[model samples]
Target chain A: MSVSELSLDRDPSSRFVPWIVAALSLMCAIALGTAFALASMTADWGRAASDQVTLRVATGDTDIPALVDQVARLEAVSRIEHLPREQVARMLQPWLGDVAQVDTALLPLPALIDVRLKPGADTSELRALIADRSEITLDSADAWLAPLQDLAGLARLVAWVLAAVAVGAIMLVTVFATRSALVNQRQTVDLLRLIGAADGYIAKRFQRHGLRLALFGGIAGTVPGLIVIFFATAAARLQGAALLNGLTPSLAGWLAIAALPLIVALVATFTARVTVLKLLRASW
Target chain B: MQQQGTDGTGEPLVAMRNVGLRYGTGPEVLRDLDLELAEGSFHFLTGRSGAGKSSLLSLLHLSRRPSRGLMRVFGHDMQDMPAREVPVLRRRIGVVFQDFRLLDHLSAQENVALPLKVANSMDSDRIDEIVQELIEWVGLSQQAQARPPTLSGGEKQRVAIARAVISSPRLLLADEPTGNVDQEMGERLMRLFVKLNSLGTTIVIATHDLSLPGRYGYPLLHLEDGRLSNESGGAA
Candidate 1:
């Protein structure tokens, strides 16, 4: 058909449906990608926290004066805070809630030490340094956070698999839709064949149609997905200091989400083109 | 008849020799038919309902290949031609289906514009002008935007005819073009076909409408069962 006639027949607005699908696919991709990022970040945080806690416990026997001197000697040690028994007890009171029985006896609470490390401080070297200080004992710091971090990693892996499955589902839907359109327009196709239309031309029309639908659908699916992600991120940020660390999406993460709709569109286009070509070859 | 090969000049629009066809090894629908249609020669094909009128037209339109013989169009042998080449040849042949096979999604004008669009040969102005003229010719101008589902039988038939001839093809095949129309509309459609023929478009009308051949004084090839009858006569 003439280009103008083709344009007249095509509804440009019809593209919204595939765009929606692409958008949804994008959202899924973002979710998957965010889960991956969170998993990595949490894992790193858990390891650091655990090592710090271990160092604090190992140094527990060091006299206050000796510990202060040791802390002053280490270049990696940026800042240190020594908490007395009363402060430790106060901190535990929220969970312990009116511990009158423990108050009568001396609470066997270890002195709390907060240490900040310099940027790029090697955790292994620092752990070794604290280990040599026999007067000090450092128990594991964020040992409790390991399970949460591991769970995040597992969730990330599952999200990746779900994204892959979503892509497969999109391809199947495009193929099914193209086939139905071909069936409905069977007579028209036959007529076109009779009049000397090339299979490429016939397939092009369908590909264009399919691509548009997929793009719209992807957009539809992605917008709500992104919205959900946005809300989750915002909620995490709102927790402020209470959160272990605020989750921040990087530029690459956002870009990956944005690129998803285009990917869905491409997949739909190719699937439709291949399906139409196969059907034409078989029938005509 | 001597089977003409490519003579370096423009090829004969259609040539078939000992052409036979059947449905999946069943009895042949068309048996050993030898025919040549020079460019722009108009003829009428008359036969009983099951005598393979549609099958012959299908072959002419490249919808099916002959099972037992050679067929060539515009100098290209169809037997070994790649499947991709079929549509290029189809663009030059216009076919009016017996069933008025208009697309339900498209309006009358869009349906008629389909041929020109398929060929990718016209600009908007030319397409619009030609489509408008044809629609006017078929008296469907008032229903230009109406889709096939809403159109009357006669209206649908006219839309099909308009589509078939819209490309101004080198050959036009109309199978029972007037089958669904009243006598008045049939005559009008025939006049349109005659006008197209006079303009150097080869036309083949496949019909049981004996009155058409008699009225137009065109040569008639009559078929019975799967064979052509030897007797040649004109209606009084």
Candidate 2:
């Protein structure tokens, strides 16, 4: 037999808990999704660059063959692939569209060679060797990769900050909602008190109600966000992995969305529990 | 004035000594009172409109503590008891207010089942059965499903009375329970209290209707100037 003498009809339209939790849930989904995507992209970039270096030789330089020979003999060098001039030009197509009108020999284009290093090999000796050649320039992809990776890391940080703010907002809204509920049910509270109801009993009732509202609202808000992310990822992939393609979360991000309702519900429940306990103590 | 008047047993149900109550900085509403109620005792706590009858009942209901002196219920010092233990102490007593104080949202049956719910009765089926029976006993069976706002004054009073005694509380206190009902309905409600008292429930009713107590031969406890003028003999 529950002591729930209160009718939720106190103000039926005043139930803004679901909308509040839902909006927070949507924001949480976006943050988590973006963070997870950026993190995975950063990991992929690091793995590809960790054991490799690239070298650029001026296109018309006849010393390229000797440079390649010397580079291959280095203890750190495993194998090197010399890029055809056309391939290098194609790589620069986005910035210099259709440069074929210029004569290939007179073009300022450079021939690129990709170097794969043996595990645990020293690239310092190779760098010293390449420094002696005026026509050969050695560059590790990580030079720019590091900053790109850092940008991804920074994005992940921003997502985490967003998540923290969402959780804070959840607590704030739950506190106000719990307060409103307490005021609305003031008569019920007094009646229960006069009838010898334990404080835990009263608190439990409000906590349960608040948790339900948060769960419903949170799930309602999160599902649409997940769908939007999924469709956006699909649309981008259909366009052939265009720039800014990795906007979808990895498996873990989806899992977080799956569990978001419970997490937010717990937040609401715990907040209500604490708020009710404090108010009841003050009444005493 | 620690007059110990136990009924059959050695310990009185309630014992008070020079108890006085003041709200914040206000003047005392009850003061300098020494009293004891034996188990199963019945008293009509009566006075004029502003003579502190309800204030005395506030103490009895554990609504507030005395600013000075001692107040004990069921042999436990109220001031010395932990705040958390107030609910446990309150479960032993029941109160009916002048306004009835029935929850407007809950149905009459729900209102009546409140004390039983507070007592944490395990058998839901039995609780339902008893609540229905009590509603019938109060002659509101037809109105059992009705909300407080929809019921007549007499019907609301009946529900309040049922709620107060549903737990079979050791102490039952009513403040002007019959204030809203007509003469016949008031008499009928008084008989209900009398019947509960006969069933070994200690009853105290604060009312201006003095005839019912004399008719039932229960003592009248009169209040004046925030002090009790104990009238032990019935009908005095």
Candidate 3:
């Protein structure tokens, strides 16, 4: 066949495959992006709360004056609130049952001072400072909370790994889908070759098809991803905790979600192009 | 044999000297074959089934390279030409396969318009006009809008033929083109080939039909077990 005649045999339906690939790729991007956003928010919350060390200080009547003097010498203390024995008892009344008269003889009721640490103070340095104030017993607020913060960090790391795995899976699926399309059109390719169609022409058709498929898949995938992210944020708020506080994606996040389709389309296009070229080189 | 017009140049349009073809170190399907097709000549190649007729046409169509010997097309040595330049040479040749090879998805008109579209030589309006004319000429006017699956065997053959000659190729190659058609249709199709040949196109048809060459009075090239013999009283 003449070059002019060979030019005419293109398939119109080839466009759809690339569009689908593009859509799928976009969805994968949104899934990955949302995961990162959530993880960052959780990390930030832990970091903010971990920066400060709060102490609860108690002193009996004999050491009251000395305890006050010792508390004044601690450099880590940012603000101290002094509470009398009656106030401490009143605060504990909700947890204590039927102890109004019985506890007066056995319980050693003492005055209390609540100490907040300065932002830059090291937890160990604050502990050492409190240890020097022997007349008052000081307990670090983070002694029990430290393990919880560590767990949150570990969870964030796992979320990141999960996101990476999802992206890899998306790529693998896209490659397989593109390969299927190429195989389906194998006869068309042979016909084109027989008619003297250039390799670039054949590759372009497949690339365009892949880009379209990725775009459609990506867009479709984003809707469910965003829904998942929304429910997650809502659940976190309902639980009286801020999961993605400072890292909450704004309008930009929504825009990125919208752009997922286009990004996937580009990836599909390039991937299909390379795959088709390789196949043609190997076969032709 | 009648002597036709001489170009004063002896070079044939297609010249293959001692050409041998094999698939991956296997025995050659065609071995040490010498052949030539002069400009504007009409020839019929006849052989039993599996006699390498298709293979030889494939080589002529530039789809495959000979494993040994020298081949040339349109005055360019096939061995010396770069791989990229093969397409340029193939553009001058048109082929009609035994199975019709029409794209199932396209309408008859679109299938016929394929060659012109690939070459990008004709505008859309011109392509449509030419395709319509060819469809009518092949007596497939009613089936022009029909897809290959919907068309009959004869209709598909017409579409394939229309596509092959749509660009007015310099050389036309047909492989059992009328194998599926009735006797009347086959004769009509042969008339079309003759008309195209008279208009200065070189035509080579490979067929199993024995009486076709006797009826048309064209030169016959017989092939049996990969060997070529000229039964007609002339140098081939």
Give the per-residue lDDT of model 3 (tens digit) for B33-140: 788788898988888888889988988888888889999888888888766666656668888999988877678888888767666665889888988898898889
Per-residue C-alpha lDDT of model 1 across residues B8-112, encoded as one tens digit per residue: 365667887888889896999998776777676677898888998888888888888888899998788988878887787787788888898777777889888
Tell me the tens digit of each residue's lDDT in model 2 across B74-134: 9899888877888988888988888999987678998888877766755778889999888
Give the residue spans of candidate 2 off by over 4 A.
Answer: A1-3, A9-13, A56-79, A84-111, A117-137, A232-243, B1-4, B7-9, B210-214, B230-236
Per-candidate DockQ values are 0.40, 0.55, 0.22
Q: Per-residue lDDT of A1-284 in model 1, one digit per residue for the tens?
A: 22322331344434344654565486576666576457545755754664353234432455776666676467776666776556777777777886654582366665667666665664454567666666556555455666867777787787777788788878877777777777767766776677667788888988888777877777767766666666777677677743335364556666666667778889989998999999999855
- Tens-place lDDT per residue, model 2, A1-284, is 45366554354533777898899988987777777777766766665676688887765645766777878888888898888878877787777777676555666888788888887675797789877677778778778878887888898999989977997898898898888888888877887888998888788888888788888988998898788767866776578753345556778878987788899999999998999989988865
Ranking by TM-score, best first? 2, 1, 3
Query: What is the overall TM-score of model 2 with all chains considered together?
Result: 0.85
Worst 10 residues of 3 chain A by lDDT: A1-10
Task: Say which prediction, candidate 1 or candidate 3, comes out ahead on lDDT.
Answer: 1
Per DockQ, the best of the predicted structures is 2
lDDT of each: 0.73, 0.81, 0.70
Choose the strongest candidate by lDDT: 2
What's model 3's overall lDDT? 0.70
Please identify which of the two predictions, 2 or 3, would achieve the higher TM-score against the true structure.
2
Location of the lowest summed lDDT over 10 successive residues in candidate 1 chain A = A1-10
